[model samples]
Target: MNTLYFAYPGELETPTGGYGYDRKIIAGLEDLGWQVELVPLGAGFPFPAAETLSQAQTVLEGLPAGAQLVVDGLAFGVMPEAASLACGRLDLVALVHHPLCRETGLSEDEASGLFESERNALGHARHVIVTSHATATQVADLFGVAEERITIVLPGTEKQDFAARGSSGKLKLLSVGTVVRRKGYDLLFAALDGLRECDWHLDIVGGLDADPGCHAALLQQLSGLGLTDRVTFKGAVAPQDLSGFYRQADVFVLASRYEGYGMAYTEALAHGLPVIGSGGGAVADTLPDGAAIYCGTEDTGKLRSALKLLMTNESKRLDMSAAARRAAEALPDWRDAAAQFAVALGGVRR
Candidate 1:
């Protein structure tokens, strides 16, 4: 079998959409008859300590010549210098969910360094794959890369039977992702606060992965909003349990400030639940025209209005639920994504 090197700084335990994306892609590649070896750079990760950096350098040096290497953008975005060294030695391709430059809450120096590094690293790649057109545009504008050089591969969602909407049951408001400030859980809490008069249960499904401090702060904020009773923080649900949560919910709400690609929304839609999401980045493009009420910002009034509109009107929710399923059906499976990716990589010499 032709070997493909899958390099990531974060280990298997990293709990985020990016980690999930890497695993899915690796699996898909293996199913498509490629020998995919997962090479982890250990815990220190993208912002590695001196030891982690040395270890990653050793891993890079040992890769066989002419082997196709796939790297996470996060692993390379911080250290452009390291990327240049990798590029000189390997046939590297980058799968960028979003640039680190676009990350929230970075010091000016840190952001500047990441921006430069990503640009350098992206330039060195044989192929630059992104999850959405929104990210492609951002990459072009920020890094001066032409749009044609970028490939858009939407993330795949697991298949599930869409549950029947029960009319007499308590409405479930669902949100899933890591507990991070960038995810805008704080805004979601504010939005849910406005819905206090309504009969609804909020299920915030996710755990802290990269940042524990932010997670604690978000929990405090949730408590301060007096939503502890109404909101259930089901920390780090396994893949098996995630399907059940989707099936149980009536409405799926994703209150992210922005996303490169919103996989949670796709999963909810697949389960036949009407989605309510913020209309930031690629959320509008990924979702069906009417599958969701896209709140353009974190405004409480708009979120409340959308919640009321989706929750109170049974027929509207039903229609949107159908639309959401249709959208999910239209999406290509991971197998298809892998086939397309293979075609792209086939152009490169063995």
Candidate 2:
């Protein structure tokens, strides 16, 4: 009864925040004495090819009868037919990081389709696990899920050694997330373009493989703004390598249009780095008041101002860095996150 199947898209070790959450939650559940088995659902999820979707359905159907299934929202939100078909044989629990319809790049038709499918899909789920209050609200209000069916288990932060910033005269800025349109890399580039007079360098640590079109467009914008030398796209790096980027950075920033829980922001705070961000959606609650300087995603002028305040004013940055550490001290670790998940699953079992 303690054994559960965790169905996710592609590899569990992937570097993106959603995959990373899946990995940590699995480990935490294991620590809680629950046996978790990973089921790969192939790749290109949420926009998978027809064959991929069919194969994913087959994978789910192949699981043992009445197996406890916790499916990642990336693929789960699209499977109304599969979910309905499996109703009597499988116990379905959806881990919805966010509603698929809310992704920024979708057209009206695409968004409406996702909304309908996810709403229909949720009707089959016994419970929904979300990472934030914002996402939980979205599930209940926008996705037509009930309040009693939702569980909010916030993303946990790892305790890390405080970043010992270097003596380099130039400010080192770090931005972490997949290089996608939703992350607002375009706005970040434009805002930094206005502060060309300052001695600053940006290191974007993220995977470029997720969205080729977005990555290509970002490259064009970077070149257009004459930032080829100012910003370095480190792509995705190993966790050990990423730690070095965090340790050397003076400030952390990402102009994300939205976030489910903003795991990157919390990771930044854990390293004691002051953050500059839009603090969109759940991110506003993810980061504490004194830990970050936030601006609206569309307000490049204000974003530039926040960037300037952190870059030119060392004292203010350091003050926020201290606050970031204090705030991070209060966030839950993996064990706590897993315990929350366990409670949600317990309800399903009952």
Candidate 3:
């Protein structure tokens, strides 16, 4: 049957890449004639209240017999009891953006607990869909999911004309992602501080509420580093506004400490913006060679040098911009991503 229920936490319209991925995939599936029902499990996922967990569990346990259920890892990881019960009566698929334990700012105990919970929950999945090859490896090695049971379906990119530099005198550097510790904005700030002599204005496009302490620290860091005037935190923006930001950008930079598969990086490539970023997580793997200049994740000096190279060398930036456009051509579109997802779903065993 071409029918499935997609269960996830939070509102579907959240401006994060993960949510955006879900939205596009669901829409693509619908275009392909799949009967997909979205199940909003709850907003406080992965750490929902006791009652919320109970309610989610009840909902899962009561789904029609022999139904196809695909649960997002954020909510599924912490609900092993529901997963264990649901798998017996349904073909349960686990859609993991990344393993929960790898998130930054978690205590060792919390990390360990999440690891155990995710591992337990994943054990019940008839099949697993991950966003990148690196994440599939992590699921197999760290979470004990068999490699044969996992499928890597990457995020698709929209077609965009090449990004053009704005009329502003300073180079426009763009960064996209939530203002959280995992994104390495602290390291990015330090790196940019060393390049203060360069003419650049950074526009950070992301939500500031995901990690309040991290956002507050970043604001304080910006002030202490004397970058308050050079940086603008535009906050989460609508898709149209974000596209405008991309069009006006000279270079796209992000120093994410880890990522399942960086949808933002691919977006920048699609826009044909020269890229500067770290080799953390799957980012290096995501970009084709020459599409970006990468540095060590925690090396402020190296990141600064990479940024300066792109900022000061228009010739090199042009070459990378061309490469970015070339790389984007090889990336999957939404229709391809949806087809890959459907194939992955076909492998699920009840």
Candidate 2, residues 69-180, lDDT tens digits: the string is 9999999988888888776688899999988998989999999999999999999998899999999988999977889989999988999987655447999999999998
Give the lDDT of residue 34 in candidate 3: 93
lDDT of 2 at 116: 94
TM-score of each: 0.95, 0.97, 0.97
Candidates 1 and 3, the one with greater TM-score: 3
Clashes of each: 0, 0, 0
Model 2: clashing residue pairs?
A: none
Model 1 per-residue lDDT tens digits across residues 131-207: 88898888888987777677887787776776678686688888988877777878878877877778899888887
Compared with the true structure, the alpha-carbon lDDT of candidate 2 equals 0.89
Model 1: lowest-lDDT 10 consecutive positions: 341-350
- CA lDDT, every model vs. true structure: 0.79, 0.89, 0.88
* Candidate order by decreasing TM-score: 3, 2, 1
Ranking by lDDT: 2, 3, 1
Instruction: Name the lDDT value of residue 265 in candidate 1.
Output: 86
lDDT of 3 by residue, 1-350 (tens): 38989998988888898889998999999888999988888878778999999988988987899999989888989988899999889999999999999998899999999999999999988999999998898999998898889999999999887655433568999999989998999999999989889999999999988889999999999999999999999999987689888888899999888888899999999999888777456887986789887776677888888898988888888888889999999999999999999988877744
